[model samples]
Target: MNRLFAATGFVPKKDIRGIILNRWGHAFVTPQPGFFFDTATRTAPRNTVMKGYGRISFGHAELEGFQHWGPAADQGRRAMTQALKNG
Candidate 1:
């Protein structure tokens, strides 16, 4: 499932200022920690306090399924930075 989602080229884009959150993501913090705080949640939303906050992890290193500090993650961060800067 992790590989399948990663292959879809999907990156959370709802973040207004790059804030990310996960209700219950077990995939995070281990085999796929990259998505720990962005997507791939293991539970449903229960708190309303986080409402209005941006949920996108635009250029997060591991959010894209790449291992932290990996070359691919670096490239993704760079790309997201550039995109944000250009706009």
Candidate 2:
């Protein structure tokens, strides 16, 4: 399953900012619902509470493997930095 997803580009080819893999081998595109809500309540204005809040839905279970061993956090950070530098 994981191989299929990777072959089809269903999962992220690599990790990026704000993305993380869960224990179930699924990619969490955004923070969990509760955590997002809590953070929004504390730091975001009411109007913007839903601004950056969203869900992580995937079309393939194979890609879900990313939730377990996707790229490391620092790797994601470096990728973001490199993207910014190149752009």
lDDT by residue (1-87, candidate 1, tens digit) is 335565676454532346567665323323333323434554322122112134322343333445455844674666566566555
Each candidate's TM vs. the true structure?
Answer: 0.22, 0.22
Q: Where in model 2 is the C-alpha error above 4 Å?
A: 1-22, 27-71
Cα distance off (Å), candidate 2, residue 64:
19
User: Where is model 1 more than 4 Å wrong at Cα?
Assistant: 1-69
For candidate 2, the 10 contiguous residues with the lowest summed lDDT are 56-65
Across residues 1-87, which tens digit of lDDT does each residue of candidate 2 receive? Answer: 456576666555453335555654433444343432336336423223323223311132122223332434444454455455555
Model 2 per-residue lDDT at 4: 56
